[model samples]
Target: MSEAPALPPVRRVGQRSTLAYGFGAAAYGVKDFGFSTFLLLFYNQVLGLPAAQVGFAIMCALILDAFIDPLIGFLSDNTRSRWGRRHPWMYAAALPIAAGWLLLWNPPELSQDAMLVWVFATSVLVRTAISAYEVPSQALTPELSADYDERTRLTAYRYLFGWAGGMVTLFVTYTWLMAGPDGQPDQLNRANYAGFALFGAAAMLLAIFTSAIGTHGEIKRLPRPEIVTKPLGTHFRELWATIRNRAFLILMLAGLCYYSAQGISFALATYLYVHVWQFDTAAFGTLALSLFLGVSGAFVIAPRVANRVGKPVAAMVFMFSAAALLATPYALRLAGLFPAPGDRVMLPLLLTLFAFNTGCGVSATMLGASMMADVVEDSEAKTGRRSEGVFFSGAFFIQKCCSGLGIFAASLILHFAGFPKGAKPGTVGVEAIDRLTLYFILAYLALGWAAALIYRFFPFGRDEHAARVAALAKGEAG
Candidate 1:
């Protein structure tokens, strides 16, 4: 074999660099909130589409994303560019992704079929655009810093900004846009979404570009090891090899289950908060603020938690804690211990539960992502190949696919409960609300714990990764 190309040494990535790159996840946050929080509600309640159809449409889009992501990863891994493989794709994705997102909320009035088509088409474009940026951008992480602990710290910063971005969007949508004209908080106000979409699209563009431009200078400093050129058939062989990695497979499966639960919970939360709990607009805003606080706090706490207990353990603990906490309200309600709607204790109790759950839930996500970063080192050592783009793409792919399944599960539950579209909050039957709540609780508990359990199979850890890095260093010198 030909001599391997010289690669740049791993350096201590500065705080400024992490800050800039970290904010890019803000774009992902914006996209994620749009899909998980509003897409189903907007279509089913506002436009009068069936909940199942709306959920299925988004799922179709996610399926497309699942395939497209890996393709982008493969392409970016093999790409040659002066501005660098990751940056160029990141910059190129900004406007298209933003415009695609904005257009999703602006679908013209049409037949139900036409509307479904619109949702699917727009969702595909938006997610594909996200993949172009996110896959490569995340792939850039291993290049930026090789230190295991520093990777956790960097992801912490990223998740913080990610939470901030989504919180801003939620606050604006709930407290301002959806609050409606005087005395009527109309979340069903279709016009309000136009404003939300405009702002979200603009923010997405800004976040993507800012990170891309900020990190442009560091491209030359990153290692650019020449990939071994192989026949086209070898592509399938490598992909199969990647899939067979036990650690990666475990993470992917767990993430699919966990994020699916999250997707369903997020979709159903507004319905429960406004209808079952009978919270008004201002209270909804407060709930959003509470969730934001929890997520923010968790971001600060995650790196420390990881340092103390190790990443895998920290991820499981946080993940399980979040799930158990999310099940609290429903469990209480089912057992007759929950405060009645409009009781003084109800809102405070709800807020407290939501905050803790959100904090732990987000921390779980950050820890898992950081762990995946470590997996890159392990995978390279075993396979004797660098494949950050391919690996990170799997993470994003699992997230999107599972998010689709979550929405689909929610739709099934809602349909079974006989919940009607366009039904005002507090107007649905007590039976429907009760059924929804119980299903929500069970889904969260089961899926979340299962994810945690599955994650226990990951074999790599501090000593394993350290050994891998040392071996890699020796090989490079040879």
Candidate 2:
């Protein structure tokens, strides 16, 4: 087996470069905002498809795209190009992502079955296109810096911008595009989605191009793997061996659980806001601001916390904290100890809890991703290969699959709650809303706790990662 050639030492990435790299995640954030926050509502309420069918179509798309992520990752890893391995794929994905984003929200009138097929196909296209960029783009994290704290900081930037992009778009959608003439939110108006879709497509295109171009200068500084003549089976064997690292597997399990909880929260956000909370346009905008502020707080909090405790411990702490806070509002409401849905105090209270919840949750996620970057060195030390693409893609693969399940679970929640189709805000029965809140609280807490506990099983810390990095450096020096 050929080891990867040593190319460059880890250096502190410059602010410009870090910002560029981080901004690229906005493209993905835009895609996520559409899929997680709006897709179900648009299809179910605006287009008149059933919630279960929308969820099924999206789940299928996500699962299919999950399989495609590894291929993109593998191809990007092995590709030899003057522009370097990752950027070409990132550049190639921009236009398709834009087109797919447009098509996904602009489906023409069709029978329910045909619409389902359209939803499935467009969703697959969008997800695959985004994966082409994201898998490779994220794979850049480990290559850019191998330092423990630096990776955490970089990951924080990525999450901050990702959340900012999504939240900004969301804020704009609720306050402007989706608002009625009377200044209330009118999300069920099909015409409102056209502007949202266009804005998202444009944002995605700009983000992809900006990041690919912005980071283009680092091509020569990144690692250059040795060209080896390996047969198809050998490559697959190596890929499998690399991903089978114990730490990587543990992180994947944690990600599966964490992202599942996130998916449920995101998929049901609009439902909870509109039906249960009766939030108006102003309230939605404020919620988006709160979420953005939370993630920004995470940008400051994650690395500091990870530096104090180990990444795994910090992640577990944040995960557990986030879960408890997330469940608090629902539990309070269910217990009849919370503000009424339309109470003046309800919005502020919810926003405050959500801000803290997002801060903790995003911190946990940042630490986990940084942990994955650390895994690259650990795997390279053990296997004589640096498989950043494979590792990150594997992480994303788990996230997409599990999050898909979460979305499906959300649909089930709605179905079982007997949430009526086309029901306006404030009209959903108290019983159904209560049922929805209970189911969400239960699932969210269960998954959150499971993920936090699973994080404890991660076998390495900063010291282990440092040792692996030094070992790899020594081997290369020899």
lDDT per residue for candidate 1 within 316-337, as digits (tens), equals 9988899999898888988899
Q: Please, what is the whole-model Cα lDDT of each candidate in the order they appear?
A: 0.84, 0.87
RMSD of 1: 2.4
In the order shown, the candidates' Cα RMSDs to the true structure are 2.4, 2.3
Clash counts per candidate, in order, are 0, 0
Highest TM-score scorer: 2
TM-score for candidate 2:
0.97
The regions of model 1 sitting more than 4 angstroms off are: 1-11, 182-184, 476-478
**Clashing residue pairs for model 2:** none
The runs of at least 3 residues in candidate 2 whose Cα sits more than 4 Å from the true structure, single-residue gaps closed, are: 1-8, 476-478
